[model samples]
Target: MKTKHYLTLADAEILMNRAVELSAQRSFNMSISIVDEAGALLLMKRMDGATPLTAHLSLEKAKCSAMSRRPSKFYEDIIRNGQMGFLTLESVTGMLEGGEPIMYEGQLIGAMGVSGAKAFEDAEIAQKAIHDFFQQIS
Candidate 1:
């Protein structure tokens, strides 16, 4: 029988490792977090210089991404333009920064989050991780 969800143990490992590599290369130590489709923690890493606040934010962003099944940075754009509707939706949605959903076969299987640097930088690393994920499978 064909396998189920696109996510696999190997995928998880590659994603986590890529996050670490990007974090190091950027010289922005961070706390990285991943969550499954159901918004459950998968794996997390805290670099040497990551701040305590990064821990919670990392998880929050990962959770937000998983829940929204969209790049959390998109919300940043909405907020930047002063979209109060989107801001109020935050009360009902898990939207936040630093997280992005992981997709395969056009389906979301998980999300990733990184914190420590600026929100955009963290989002960049997360985006690289996601891009690398698709590359790993392709």
Candidate 2:
């Protein structure tokens, strides 16, 4: 038997609302997205002033994170350190931060993405949403 896993749309929206609140407190318009276990789109939103492009890039970054099962920043580090593997990794380098895998029962269930601000800020928003949402999950 397999334990089913994926972030439901309601849960994704709950997380996104928290993200919006946090970004609003900091006055950042953001692009946010949540993808399921297969890295398929689930939910997405763009704040009032978020640029249109952020929507696309944010989703892709999240997909990259889910596919790699690691924070996007780690890849950023590898490239910044001039690792040879990164030479052909440009296609995977959204290492710009703000992407995280969603976990349930110690397994990767999905991922979240955020953009429309600094890389660190986007990362922070995604982290906060994950923390807050999971607190109510189990």
Candidate 3:
């Protein structure tokens, strides 16, 4: 059998809290989602005043990022460049900027997604949270 790493509940909580803290700092009511490498939802939160839709969108974004092992912006850029065919890819929805893969020890273990703000701002929260997480672990 082969070995694989996965995000624990504690790890997910740290990511969620960091993302929420970042969003709060920006005064942006946001939704955040964390997913394991297999695109399984690990934890999610929707800040007060954030739209309900943000919760669902954040989950999809997390799944996309975890499964694709790349920032959701990569797929969004492809569609923006007229590569509409990308939209037809199987199980590859949520092609937006807020989703980013989470890596540890040079391996992708999960992903994080943020919503209810500008696309770039959402991406910033996810990226910053992951950066802080890695710093803490290091």
lDDT of 1: 0.80
> Could you give candidate 2's per-residue lDDT for residues 74-111 as a string of tens digits?
77777778773625444754565888888888888888
Worst 10 residues of 1 by lDDT: 86-95
Model 1, 15-125: lDDT tens digits are 989989988997988998888887788888888988887877788788888887888877667766777463455342334567889887777899988888988888889
Judge candidate 2 at residue 118 and give its lDDT: 89
Q: Predicted candidate 2: what Cα RMSD to the true structure?
A: 1.8
Question: Which parts of model 1 have CA positions greater than 4 angstroms off?
Answer: 1-6, 85-95
User: Each prediction's Cα RMSD?
Assistant: 3.0, 1.8, 2.2
lDDT of each: 0.80, 0.83, 0.89
Off by over 4 Å in 3: 1-3, 86-93
How close is every model to the real structure, measured as TM-score?
A: 0.83, 0.90, 0.92
Per-residue alpha-carbon lDDT of candidate 3 for residues 39-132, written as tens digits (9 for 90 to 100): 8999999999999989988888888899889999998898888877635544445888899999876778999989999999999999999999
The candidate that achieves the highest TM-score relative to the unseen native structure: 3
